[model samples]
Target: MASTMSRLMLGRTLERICKAVLLLCLVHFLIMMILYFDVYSQRFDIFSRFNNGRGANASRGPHHYYYNYSRPNTTFPSYLPGADQLLPTAKPEANRTRPTPKPIPPCPEVPPGLVGRLLIEFSSQMTMERVQRENPNVTEGGKYTPTDCRPKQKVAIIIPFRHRDHHLKYWLHYLHPILRRQKIDYGIYIINQLGEDTFNRAKLLNVGYTEALKDAEYDCFIFSDVDLIPMDDRNLYHCYDQPRHFAIAMDKFGFRLPYAGYFGGVSGLSKKQFLKINGFPNEYWGWGGEDDDIYNRITLNGMKVSRPDVRIGRYRMIKHERDKHNEPNPQRFNKIQNTKNTMRKDGISSLTYRLASVKKYPLYTNISVEIGKPPPRPIKG
Candidate 1:
C-alpha cells in the first residue's frame, strides 16, 4: 500500500511541471505574434505615407517627382528580411516635352544714343584704312547690329558704285557713326559695274537687292548715291509704309529739290514695296532717267515718296566730276515717257548679269558684275 501512494504522487508532480512549461510557451508565443503584427503595421503605415506623398506630387508634373532611386550606385543588404520588396517600383517618365523659349522683343524706335543734327565734315586725308580703324564695330561685309537691343529693322544700304573711292571714304566715315546712333541693324553693299560700259545704276541697284537677300533676309533696302551723306542722325535708315526719300534737300541742288518729281539721291524701299513696283526699270542705262523712271513706277503702283522735314532730311554731296562712261543717255526722255509700258517686263523679272567677283572688306561688301552693254540700237531699215 505504501509503495502505490508514492508512485501516484510522483506522477502528479511530473504532470504539474509539464503543464507549467506548456503555459509559459503559450504566453511567449502570444507576445511574439503581437510584436510581429505591430512591426508590420508600422511598416505598412510608412509605405502608405510614401505612396500618398508620391501621388500628391504627381499633379505637379514629372519634373517635381522624377528621381533615379534604382541607380547603379544604390545598394541593398541581402541579410535584411524582404529588402528587395520594401518599396514599389518607379515608372519611366512618359511623353516629356521641353518648354519653348520666349521670343525676343523688337528694339525701341529711337535709340538712346541718338544725338540729332550731327556735325558734318570732309577732309582730303581721309583714307579707307582710317575709316575702317574708326569703325571697328562694323564687321566684315559691313554688318552691324546694336549689342544692347534687337534692331527695329534690318537695312541693306546699296550704293551703285564705280570709280569713286574718294567719295566712298567720306561716306563710310560719316555714315557708320550715324547708322550706329540710329540703332540700325545694317550692311553696306557696293554694287560696282565691272567694265567701262555705260553705268547701269538701276540694274546695279536691282543686283544689290538680289545679292543682299542671299546673305541675309534684309527687309529694308536703302538705294543711295555714294557721294551723298546725311547731315542728321535722326534721318533714320529704316523702311516705312511708303517709299522713303532720305536725301530730300541735298546741298548739290542748293539744299532744295530741283523739281517736284525729283527722286534722286538716297531712297529707302521695303522688300514688298520694291516687288510691288517690279523694281526699278532695267532699261535706264544712264544717270538722268533711272531716278525719274523709278518715281513713275512708284506712282503707277499707287505708292508715294515719304520724307522727313527739311531740317532732318539735310544732306551734303561730295563734289566730284561726272564719270567718263556715265554720260547722259540721249534716249532718257523717250524711256521716261514709256515707263508704264516697260516697267513690268523690264524690271527685276527681266534682269540678268554675270558676277565678276564678290569681296567682303572691313567697311563694306563689294559686288562687281558685268551687266551687258546696252541693247544695240535697232538696225534702221
Candidate 2:
C-alpha cells in the first residue's frame, strides 16, 4: 500500500514542471510577432509619405523604392545608408518659358526685280501722265525707295535742262524702271535754266547740288543729261570710291568712246569726291568745254574714273537739233587751257544764281533758276 502512494506523487510533480515550460514558450512567440509587425509598419509609412500617399503599394519592392527616390523634388532620408548611390540625380525644373527670337532683315546687294538686259522703246504717245501712272511708288518730289528691302545708297539725279520736253518724257519712261531694278533710293531734280542767255550747263549742275542737299542728305550725286538713257539696267547709277562715268559707250558714237578724256553724258560723284574737285567749272557757258574741264578737275584731284564693262555701260541718245542760243563759246579752248589756275576760283564757291521757282512735278523736281550772261569779250587790237 505504501509503494502505490509514492508513485502517484512522482507523476503529479512531473506534470507541473511540463506545464511551466509550455507557458514560457507561448510568451516568447507572442513577443517575436509584435516586434516583426512594428518594423514592417514603419517601413510602409515611410514609403507612403515619399509617394505623397498615392497608393499603399506605390513602392512595394526595392526597385520601386529606387525609382520613386530618383524623381524630381523627392526628399531622401539621411538615416538610410548609401541611398544616393541607388538612384540617378534629378535635374531642376525651369520656372519660366524661353523667349522667341526676332527675324533678320533682308540684304540689298542683289535686287529681285533686276532684268539684266532691257528693250528700250520710245513712242510719241508716251506722256508724262502715263509715266506717272506707271510709277505710282514715286513720291511727290520724285523720291523712290524699293519696297522689298532697304537701299544700299541714297542717290540724287541732277539733270540740267533748258527745253526738251519730249526727251524728258522718254527719260522718265525708261529710267524710273531701271533705277527701281538697281535698288537705289533716289530723287530726280531737273535743274532748269531760266531765260535764253547762253545756256550755262555747268553752273546749273552746281545749283542742283546745292538745292538737293536742302531736300535730303544725299550721299551720291549723278549729273545726267536729259536726253541720254541707259540701254542696260546693269549700268548702275550708284557712286563708287572714285568718279563713275556711266555713258562710256553711247549709240551716238557708234557704241564706242569718242575720246580717251570724254567724261560727259552721265557721271556719278560721291560727296567727298565732288568736294575735293571744287565741283564743275561755272565759266563753261556752252556744252563742249564744260565736260573736258570737269575731267581735268577729276585728274587734278588724284581720283581716276571708274567705268563698267563696255557691254554693260551702253546708252542711247535722243535725236534732236542743237538749241537756238546755245552756240559754241568762241573762247572754250582758251578757257580749258587755264582750268588748273581758274578751277579754285570759278567753281561752286564762286557760283551765283537767282532761284526762279521750285516745282515738284509727278515725275521730277523742276528747279528753275536765272543765271546771268557771260562777261563781254575784249576786242583784239
Candidate 3:
C-alpha cells in the first residue's frame, strides 16, 4: 500500500509540471504575436537606419545596433534602394558625416471651403499674381519648406508642360495653398517639351525627375497634370508601401474610377520605388499608354498600387481641346499590349533628352527639354 501511494504522488507531480509548461508556452506565443503585429503595421520601422520618413523613435540610442560590438559602426546604412538617399538621416555617433533630418513643422488648423469643393465664385477671384503674393514662404529656387518648422518629406512636384499657361495659372492658384496646409517641404518643376516633336509624356517625366534631382534631393515625386486639380485636401500627397493614385475620382470618369488599373492624373512615387522599375518607359510617346505602362511596371516588380478611399480622392479636370501637333500615338495600343516584351530595354536607363532651358518663377521651376523622337515602331514577334 505504501508503494501504491508513492506512485500516485509521483504521477500527480509530473502532471502538474506538464500543465505549467503548457501555460508558459501559451504566454510566450501571445507575446510573440503582439510584437509581430506592431512591426507589420509599421508603427515603427526601428531598424530603418536612416530617415525614410518612417517617423522618430526617441528611445533609440547610438548603440541600438552594432557590427563589431566593441564600438558603434555607423558607416553602412541598410540595403535600401537608391531613392533612399532622398530622405534625411540622423547625426551619426562621434561626428560621423550623415544626412541630418529636417524638423517637423507645426500642424496648423486649416479650413476648407464647403466639403473641400472649390466654388466657381471663389476660384475665379484667384489669380496667378495673387497666389504668388500670398506665398511669402518660398526658399531659394522656388522651393517651399514649411515656415513653422521642418517637414516630413522633401517632395518635388513635376508638371509635364508644353503649353497651357492658363491651365497652369489655375493649378498654381489651387495647389499651392493645399500643399502648404499639408505642411510638406516641396518644389515645383514644370517639364516642357521643346520644339514641335510629338509630345512624349513619359520621356518628359523622366527628364523632370533627373533635372529635379540636379536641383535638390526629393524623397518623392508627384507627376501632376497642369489641367487636373484635386478638390479635397484630405487626399494627402505622400509615399507609401506601394505607389499611390491620388486621382481616385475624376469628373472625366463621371466621378468614379474609370477602370481597375488606371494610374493616371496626379500620382506619387518614392525615388526607390520609381528606380526599382527603371522609371516610366520613354517609348510611350504622346498621351495614350504611358500611364498603363507605369502600372504594369509597378506590378511586374512585385508592388501593388494604393489609393485613398474613393470619397477622399475627388478631383476636377479643367476642360480643354487637344493641343495642335499633339495627335494620339497610333502605336500606343500595340506597345501596351506588348509591354512584357519591351519594358526591360526602354525605360530611364535608355532615356535620352537634351536640356534646353531652366527658368525659376515665383511659384515653381520650369525646365524645357528636347526629348528628340521615339524610335521606329517595332513589330511584334
Candidate 4:
C-alpha cells in the first residue's frame, strides 16, 4: 500500500512539471510573436538596431535604384501600341501670335504756336514773389492750380523704433515703394530717442501721434516697427473705419498667431480714432505689454480691432543684433495692469516732444523729432 501510494504521488508530480514547462514555452513564443508582428512593434522607431552584416548588402541592389533615375522613354507604353504613330507631325514653320505693343499716350496736345508762350507765362507766374497769385483755373486767392496740384492727403508713417539699423533699412527699402505706389502723400517719421534709457516703445508711438499732427494735418497714422517687412503689396498702411493690425501672421511665430489678442509689429489707426483712445500707454517700455495695452484701449473705447487674413498678412523679419536699452522690460505686466488710469494722464494730450529738424527733398519729406527722454522706471512706486 505504501509503494502504490508513492507511485501515484510521483505520477502526479511529473504531470504538474510537464504542464508548467509547456506554459513557459508558450509564453516565450507569444513574446517572440509580439516583438516580430505586433501592430505597435512595427511602429517602434526608438532603439531600433540596423543589421550591420555583409549579407544585408544583397538586399540593396545597385541596378534596382539606378534604373529608376534614368530618363523616361519618349514613346508610349507597349499597351498603347499605335498612340505615338497616330499623332500629327509638326510643320517646319508655323504662324505664331505676336502681341502688339501698347501705344504710349501722347502728352496733352496744345497748339504748337502757344506752347512756347505758355511756357514763358508759366515760368513768370511761378515766381516766389507771386506765389500767392492765382491763374484763371486757380481759386481767386489760392496760388496752386486746382488741377495742377492734387491735394495731398496727409499720411504719417509713425515708426516706434530703437537701435535697429539693418532692419530699419529693409523696412525703408520695401515700404517706400509701397507708400509711393499708394499715392496718399505720406511722410516717414521715425521717432528715435536721443539716448539709451529704458526703451519706451509706446511712448515713442504716442510721441509720433502728438508731434506728427503738430506740423501738418495727418488724417492717418501708421504705428509700425523697424523689423517687420510686409510680404504682400496689398497690406495698405492706411487704416479703414476700425483699427487695423497689419502684421497678423509673421514667420517668427510660424506664420500663425501664437494666441488671440496678439497685436504686435505693424498696426495703423486714424488720428481721430487714436486721440479718442488717448493713444497708447507710455509705461510699456521694453518689448512686451504695449501691444496688449493698445488692444485694451481699442476694446474699452467701444472699437473693434480688425486684422488681415493669414495669407495676406504675412511679414518677414530681418535677423540682426539686439538693441541697447531695448531689452525685454520685466515690469511690463505691472504697468499693463494700471494702463487704463495712466494712459488718460500721460498720453497724447499731456505728451511733449521737440522737433529736431525737417528736410524736404524732391520726392518726399523727412521730419526728425526729439522725444527727449523716456519716463521713470515703471517698477518704482
Candidate 5:
C-alpha cells in the first residue's frame, strides 16, 4: 500500500511540472507577438481602444474616423551623428513619367483671386486615424499631386520635427488640401531629429534639401515650421522669380512681419537659389539663430526675401510650450551679427550628417538624420 501511494505522488508531481512548462511557453509566445506587432506596424490589439494613446488627447466626436498611435513621445538624446549609410531612393514608380500639367488654375476658383487671408480654425487635438480618414486620397505615404493637370513646378516641402506628433497630424490635415489647391506637384518631407540633443533646426533643413534632391528632382524647396498653418492658399507654393518667403504675416505677430530680417516661419527657394546661398548654416545649434542666419545667407548670396503682401502670406501658429532644450540662444544676436562673415565658409558646403533611416510613411518621407553638436564659437573679444 505504501509503494502504491508513493507512485501516485510521483505521477502527480510530473503532471504539475508539465503544466508549468506549458504555461511558460504560452507566455513567451504572447510576449513575442506583442513586440513584433509594436515594432512592425504599431497597431494595437482590441485592447488599444482603451488606451487613448499619449502626448495629446482627444475624445472621439464628430471628427472621429479611425485611431492609432502616431509615434512614441518618449524623449531621446540626439542620435550619434554618423555618415549616411544609404542615400535617398525614389519609390518604385517615382520615376514613371507624369502627365504634363494643365494651367495653374486647373481647378475651379474658390471665391476668385486672392481674397486676402482667410481665418482658419485649428482643433485643439489631432489623431493619426483622423488625418488618414479625411485625406483618403493622400495615399499610403502622405504624398498627393493633382492628376488632372501636370503641375508647373515640383516642390519639396520640408518640416523639421522632434516631439510633436499631434502637430504633424494637423499639418497634414490642412496642408494637403492647400497644396492640391495651389496646383503644386509636391512631396511632403518631415526631417526628424533622431537624438535627445538640442534640436538643430538648420541642419535638419540641410538634410531635407539633400535627401529630397537625392530621391527626385525637386526644383523648389519650402522649409516650413510644423506649428504654422497658412491662412491663405494664395501664398503660391510654386517657385517665384526669386526666393519667396511664404509666412510673411503670422497671427502670432499680429499678422504682421515681426521685423525686417524676420525669416523664421516659412520660406522657399528654387534649387539654383538654394545652391547659390550654399544652403543654410549648419552651426546654429538651437532655435533662434538659424532663421536669421538663413536670411543672412540669402543676403550674402545677393538675394532678398521676396515676400507676398502680409495679406497674402497670413499664417496661424499652433501654440505650444517651447521645448526644454530649445531655450532662446543668448548668442543668437551674435550669430546673426556674424552671418555675412561666416556664411561663405559655413553653409551647406560644410554640412555633414549620417543618415540613420529613411522611412516613407503613409504621410511623408521621414528622413532620420544624426547630426553632431556644433563646435563652440570662439569667444569674441
Candidate 6:
C-alpha cells in the first residue's frame, strides 16, 4: 500500500511540471508577437495612407510575423526608426511637377500731360478712405481718379521757391496731395531763383509764368509763396471772375488778412486780366512791394479782388529768417503805388533776361535764365 501511494505522488508531480512548461511557452509566444507588432505596425499604418494597392496581408513568407502588422493605403513614413534600411515608398513623378511663378507689373512712367491725372489716381483711393473715416456723411468713391479728373478751365499754382530745403520738402508733401484731391489740373511751377543775387521773388515768378507756358498753355497764373501751406483743400487755386486772394487767412495775420487789398501769400490771375494789367512788375526785386504792385495793377485794370471765406483760407508760414538777398528795402512802399501807372512799360513783354543754359533732366526740363540785375533805381520817371 505505501509503495503504491509514493508512486502516485511522483506521477502527480510530473503532470504539474508539464503543465507549467506549456504555460511558459504560451507566455513567451505572446510576448514576441507583441514586440513585433509594436516595432513594425506603426510604420506600416503611416505608409498605407499614401499607397492604396499594397495589401495589409501581403505575404512575407520568411517574415510572416511582420506581414500581419503591415497596413497599406496610408501616408508613407518619412522617419521610421529602422526605415534607413527600407526603400522610400514614394518617388517623384516627372509629369506631376509644378512650374515657377510669374512676376508683377511695374508702375508706368509719368508724362507731363498725364502727371495731374496720375497724381489724382494715386491719391484718390487714399483720400476717399480717409474722408470716409473722418466724415461718415460724405459719399464714398467720390474721390477723383485720372479717368474722372477734370482740368480747371482757368487755374494756376505758383510756388515761390528758394534755398529752404525743409520748406520745399514740407510744401511738396502737403500741397501735392491737397491739389490732387481738389482735382484741379493745375500746372505747378516752382519759381526757384538760381543764384545769391538779392533773391528777386517777383522776377522769379515772371520767369515761372514764361517757363510754364513754354511747356503747356496755362491761361491763369498763381503767384504762391512756398513757405505758406494751406489749411483747407477747398480753397480752389482757380481764379473767380475777380482776382482770388486764396491765402487771406494766413497765420501771419492771426489767420486773417490785415487789410482789404491783401494779396500777399497767394494770388491767382486770369490771362485776359493779367495781360490787361500787363502782368507783375519785373522791377521789384525785394519782397514787400511786389504783391502790393500786383494789387495795384488789378485795381487799376478795373477788376476787383475776390477773397475766400476768411475762416477757410488759413495757412501756416514756415518759420525762417528772411533771405539774405531779400533785405527789406526802405523805399518799397513808394514803388508799390506806381505799379498801375507803369504797367505798360515794365511788364512781361517789355522784360529782358539772358538764358544761361537749359539742362534736360531725366524727369522734366530745366532752363536757367539770368534775370538781369534789378534797375539801379525804381522806375519813378
Candidate 6 wrongly placed segments (more than 4 Å) = 1-145, 357-367, 377-381
Model 2 ranges off by over 4 Å: 1-107
Question: What would the per-residue lDDT of candidate 2 be over residues 1-381, giving only the tens digit for each residue?
Answer: 888989989888988888888888888889989998998887886665555424555334453453354578877677654444334342224644568855435535656667877777665577888999999989988889876666667899999998888899999999998998888899999999988888998999999999999899999999999989899888888999899999999998999999998999999999889889999898887657998899999998788999989998998898889997898988889988888998899888888999989999888899999989988889899
lDDT of 3 at 45: 51
Alpha-carbon shift of residue 96 in model 5 (angstroms) = 28
The number of clashing residue pairs in model 3 is: 1
Model 6, residue 119: what's the lDDT? 18
Worst 10 residues of 4 by lDDT: 114-123
Using all chains and alpha carbons, the TM-scores for the candidates as numbered come to 0.72, 0.73, 0.68, 0.56, 0.68, 0.59
The residue ranges of model 1 lying beyond 4 angstroms of the native Cα positions read 1-105, 378-381
| lDDT of all predictions | 0.86, 0.85, 0.79, 0.63, 0.77, 0.64
User: Model 1: per-residue lDDT, tens digit, 97-190?
Assistant: 6689776667787777888887787765898888888999999999999876788679999999999988898999999999988889999999
| Cα RMSD, model 3 | 25.7
lDDT of 4 at 37: 76
Candidate 5 lDDT over 1-381, as tens digits, reads 999999999999999999999999999999999999876553343224224421134233222213332458733223412112111222236666889955645543332434445567775567777777777777545677776656667889999999988788888888887776676678899998887887889889999999999888899899999999999887777778778888888888898888898888899999999888889988777768788888888887777779887777889888999986777777778888898888888878998899999888877888888897756667889
Q: For candidate 1, what is the lDDT?
A: 0.86
Each candidate: how many clashes? Answer: 0, 0, 1, 0, 18, 8
RMSD of each: 10.2, 11.5, 25.7, 31.3, 29.9, 14.8
Question: In candidate 4, which residue pairs clash?
Answer: none
What's model 1's lDDT at 19? 97
Report the candidate with higher lDDT, 3 versus 6.
3
**Which residues of candidate 3, in runs, are more than 4 Å off?**
1-127, 376-381
Instruction: Flag the better candidate by lDDT, 4 or 5.
Output: 5
The most accurate candidate by lDDT is 1
Question: 251 in model 2: Cα distance from truth in Å?
Answer: 0.7
* Cα lDDT of model 6 by residue, 89-187, tens digit: 332366455787554332122223322211111222233234334433222211122334335453445565667655655555566556555555555
Q: How accurate is candidate 6 locally (lDDT)?
A: 0.64
